[model samples]
Target: MRRTSLHDCPAPAKLNLFLHVNGRRADGYHLLQTVFQMVDHGDLLHFDLRADERIVRTTDVPGVPEQGDLIVRALLLLQAAYARRHGHPPQGIDVAIDKRLPMGGGLGGGSSDAATALMAANALWEAGFSREELMALALPLGADIPFFIFGQTAFAEGVGEALLPVEAPDCWYVVIEPGVAVPTAAIFCSEHLTRDTKPVRITDFSRHTMNRTDSTGFGKNDLQAVAVSLFPPVAQAIDWLSAHGDARMTGSGACVFCAFSSEAEADTVLQQVPGIWRAWKAKALMHHPLNTVLQVSAVIE
Candidate 1:
């Protein structure tokens, strides 16, 4: 039997346990080193195959046009990549995103959605592309997309494409979403941004086991200060959450998170979050939930 759809595919969000800016490239892109930790809370996607080579998005995502949506772009990219290799385009797909994660909250929502679309499209189209191929194909779309395709908690470098799987502590996180969108480009281009933070070796981070009792936390996010200064809501959220523990802004800004030893500890804080902001508790996921299904997809007819 031919499978025509892949429903309820998860596109889990990620937290930058710590983000450091190493330097700037000749291309003006900032070099970075970050540990991306996958959290269980994120968006979901559904893919339905089409008979013709007409890519479409079945659902409307607020603020994201159909053509500009990363999910649609990912499908187009994959289709072009496949056509270049196989001399023929695969069938089109209709992707519906169950958008849950906050936009521009440093949660990697869009990039994660793009990665899931690529993975699910490979399976439904039976493109037979390997994980490495998919990662490479996904890189041009966004730096964070490859990390999601890597399907593990990873230590990432070089514009966040180079990846090495690392062990992340099994813990829970209480994330607070400040009602603001922190633009990534704006944060990176700011004169006050820290471009050189004295890069640390992987061993430096691997030595620290994150838990409730560990007082000496890992490296701090270098972009936090800039984001905090630019967004007052971010600063307020962090100031409040820090009372519970060491809370820091995730990637660029607008979301702050604190790690706890148990779900109960996280929930206690989640319940106390102010009504003005959105909050949730999620367990740390060492690997992606859909990792098992991301094998070499075989063509089905």
Candidate 2:
């Protein structure tokens, strides 16, 4: 029988080990240099085939309309592309998402969800697009979407589209959600935002250990200053975690994290987090979970 559904498909969240805004293009898109670090923990997606040609999401993500959810948008994009490629409309799919990550937390949770949905839909429908093709489709959805499609610890640039795989150390992290939603546009459009930090080579990051001993493991995230200034909770969370290690904001604002050498150590810190904020112990993932699923189908590795 043909494969009808893919179960337990993981959409892993990503952390920016360091984000630098190098400059802006004439198009007003910022040039960025950062490492996309995948954490093992994130939202999960399950797909079951539908008879007609209408994609639907069964789960309701708070503060997001189903019509505007990135995953839904991605599915529509994929169906359009698939129809053009195959000369027939693809089958509809029901998407059930088990969301473990927070929205607007700078964690790449939404982008990761879109990427995971795209991969699962591609296989179930036999759309036959390569990873390269899928990344092209995903990029317009979100700049961060392509990196999740790339499915590896990667170095990203060019508004976060340019991705080249890099080896980040296997480590544990204490991620603080801070219970606040920071708007990406506010941070990007901030008058105080720095738009010209010198770019660092990927090798510079690869050479250092992410563990506690390295004071300057990677360059600082340039977004942190703008984020902290706008969102007090972000600053509070960072300050709260800084007492333990080098805590930094992962993406634009709100969520912050620090690396630890072991799960026990990470868990120890997790327990000490303040009562108001939510925190978790997450391990760095070497690759996207869908990478393994794709390999099993012998589609892409």
Candidate 3:
């Protein structure tokens, strides 16, 4: 095995506070309003720097194309952007991703993976790309990619690209995955999907929000109904979870999460869930773990 410099990074999952399809754009993107909170549950990526200007993945991700890997694309985008800015290309690095998050679960795993690559490559290659510049590059990869680069709780809108940082309540999440893949594009393109929601203000969020206790005000995913209709397993998972606690789909479908005020509460629910379904008890993270790693790297420089 060729030894390489260690650049370990995290790829965290995101939960949708609420998803509203306000409308669709002429370009075919759905306009949306939602809050994105990072969770501790996600994949871990370990990067190794190489002298050659070639990008490679040491690990294979099931269901995702190797040639179209977002991590490689992110690194290439960073390399190109830096080369253009400084008038010189930098050395390349090989990435090894430990993909724990399930594909097509609407957990923002792919986007987070891409963000980790961008951040880690920036450090290893000595490319001084600002968060704003990285975010600009991330948007073309995926709308949720930018939020992971920003790496905080945020109010998201405009096809989930526009972001406004916000402070969210601390809570634990009981996330359940049904071992099924939900296609995001199919949900967005469904004719039955709700797309005429009135625009909401941030203040409106407070009025319609739910507590860990009430569970009533926690908003709905406008795409949930459409997703459930398409994927019955998603509805089954949500129904099973809702029986134990307040359950809602995180993004579009396939994964549903319930909120708990305490770890005990979350664990209790986790215990009762059937083993056939993949589940985890994780707390909402105020900051991404990679953020701390980036900070320490900055100090070393």
Candidate 4:
């Protein structure tokens, strides 16, 4: 059976339970550790396979040009990788993205979009790349890209590449997007950022202590200080949410979140949300939507 298009393929957003900057590597990339928790919410992309070699995106993704768009780049990279493996380029593809999540909100929206492209292209083209191969192709695009490919709640280290699956408590979140675009590079490069926070074992992040706002808990996102100092909206959002529960910035900034044990609790916070920010009640996903589609057992052996 031949398929013409793949639709409603979701590329969900992720929250950094806590991000810590240990030190700068010799290569200048920051070394860090964090837990990545996928949310049931995010962008959706569709693809229509083309017969000829003309890659196109059917819709405009604001702020990203066609050529530089990560989705387009993923398709091109997969084609190039296939050409290297075989003798010719694969068929072209048309991508359509229903943009939902906010960009620069530290939600991994773009990277998730890129991951979706790679997976769809692999299936649409019948390329048969292993999970490991797909992740390799993802890395050159973005650090978080590979994690989406890996597709599970994980404790990540080493610039967010290394991963160990973690059991994040089944919880819901009240995510607030402050409508400010954060510059991740600028925040990481800030002279005022914390770089030497003592590392904690992943086991220490057990469910019982995960909600603590103290120093030893999943207490802080290391970049939050820098992000708050630079983006007032992020700070404002955090403060507003804090009136209900402990809230903190995720990833590098521009969005803040607080966790609740149940959907109703999260929704209560959402109802009380101020008109200034966009708030969502999102559930944490145990795995990526594509987790079962790709067989990775072969790569393990």
Candidate 5:
């Protein structure tokens, strides 16, 4: 009997250590600078190659359209590209996603899933696309998608596509999800959004600036003020988390996190959070878990 080619992959969520909007593009996209740190808490994906040439999702993902599911779209994108280049359709794969990261929590769960699909499909299909090429495809999927393709802690700039790998300290995070969805575009488009903050150099980031070691001192989230003003739940979450430790809003809004020196400390905060609110204690990752998975697979093969 042929050995089953089991491919299990992780879709890690990200925390925006800090986000600053300094400008807006001519095409209406906002210019930004942020540090993206991967976290241990996220959704999981498992893949199995299929004999048929059609991509299928074995797991049901509600509230996401069939055609628009990032995983499905990512598979199709790779399939079409492989067909065009290789003169034949690539073998299809059945994708199973075990969702853990909360949706619309600014955890980059969706983008991470999309990246996992891209990486897994590329491997399963035997496509010879380089990481750079894969990231190019990832960009249109979501602003946060490309970083997962790179799979490392990065100082992101230029609407979050430009990446510079950074070595971040290992730390524990207390993430609190207020159980509400904050519209990202609405926050960005708000009249109250700040768009004229000055930018800082990557090397200039120091502990004294923000008194925070995990964030890039480049800037603050331009959308944060707008998010906090419009969404009282977000503000409440931030205030609640900050009362225990150093708390900051991740991404646009809806999720706020506190940093702790130890897992025990994080657990303490996690316990204090009300049972009605969604909360987790996860470690900050300096690199993406997917990268480690890929590297190990290479060695195994």
Candidate 6:
């Protein structure tokens, strides 16, 4: 059966359960190790095949120009790659984004959206690219894009490209948006940023503590201190949320989160969050909702 469109495709958000900056590459990319845990909250996307072979976005995304949008760039990249491999471009796509995640919040929303576009297009066009092939194609777009395509809770290293599937404990989170976008470049470039945390093995991150209210023993996000120093609102949010648990900023953020063992605990904190910031509770997901769509299996190196 030929499918012309995919509607309500989910592009779930992720929390860096912990991000450690191991060092810096000579090329200026930071070496990092983090556990990426997908959450139920994220943007939704709709894709329609375009007979004209022109990739387009049908809706306006705040602060993102159509051409600059990652969704468009992802489709074009796929289209070009498909043409080179198969002697003809894959049919174009029109994408609509239902944006939920905040930009620059370190939630990997844009990367997730691009990954969803690539996967959904591949399935709709019956493109035979393997999951690994799709992930490879996704890398040059964004480091986080490949992780989204990897489609599982992952322990990642090497500028976040090296991925190994790992278990993230089942838990709930109280995520707060602090109303400011923390630029990733600024956080990474800050002199105050910790660039030399001793690297730890995957086993060092025990899943046993993941569901505990005290996140104290867990590895920390190296970027969080820099983010807090630069963005006062982020610090404020973190301070406010910490009363409930071991609250920490996720990603490079303007958002901070704390884990809870039960939905009720997370919800209680969510209700008490100051009216000045937007907040919600989300459950950890072991795999991407779209994981079943990919029919191929290949180990991630």
TM-score per candidate: 0.95, 0.95, 0.93, 0.93, 0.92, 0.95
CA-only RMSD, every prediction: 3.3, 2.1, 3.5, 2.8, 3.2, 2.0
lDDT of 5 at 132: 81
Candidate 1 stretches greater than 4 Å from native: 210-216, 293-301
Candidate number with the higher lDDT (4 or 5): 4
lDDT of all predictions: 0.88, 0.87, 0.82, 0.85, 0.80, 0.87
Candidates 1 and 3: which is better by TM-score? Answer: 1
Worst 10 residues of 5 by lDDT: 292-301
Backbone clashes in each candidate structure, one number apiece? 0, 0, 0, 0, 2, 0
- State in Å the error of residue 63, model 6: 1.5
Q: What residue pairs clash in candidate 5, if any at all?
A: 19-220, 19-221
Task: Give one digit per residue, the lDDT tens place, for model 4 in 194-278.
Answer: 7887877788776645654221236578899889988889989988988877798889988898888888888888999989788
lDDT of 3: 0.82
The model with the greater TM-score, 3 or 6, is 6
lDDT of 4 at 204: 74
lDDT of 5 by residue, 1-301 (tens): 4322446688988988778889898999999988888989898899888888978888888888767788898889888989998999987788888999877788888899999889877776778887888889878878899888887878889989998876566778888888888878888888788888788667755433344543323345566678888888888887887788567778887788877767888888888898878898888886667767666331100
Better of 4 and 5 by TM-score: 4
Error of 5 at 202 (Å): 0.9
Compared with the true structure, what per-residue lDDT tens digits does model 6 show for residues 66-105?
9999899988988888898889987788898899999999
Worst 10 residues of 4 by lDDT: 292-301
Residues 1-301, candidate 2: write the lDDT tens digits. 7799999999988888889999989988999999998998898899999999999989888888999999999999999998888888899999999988888899988999999999988889877888889999999889999888888888888899888887777889999998888889989998898998988887788777444332225788998998898889999999999998889998886799998878898899999998898889888987787878866332234
Between candidates 1 and 3, the lDDT winner: 1
Error of 6 at 130 (Å): 1.1
Score candidate 2 by lDDT. 0.87
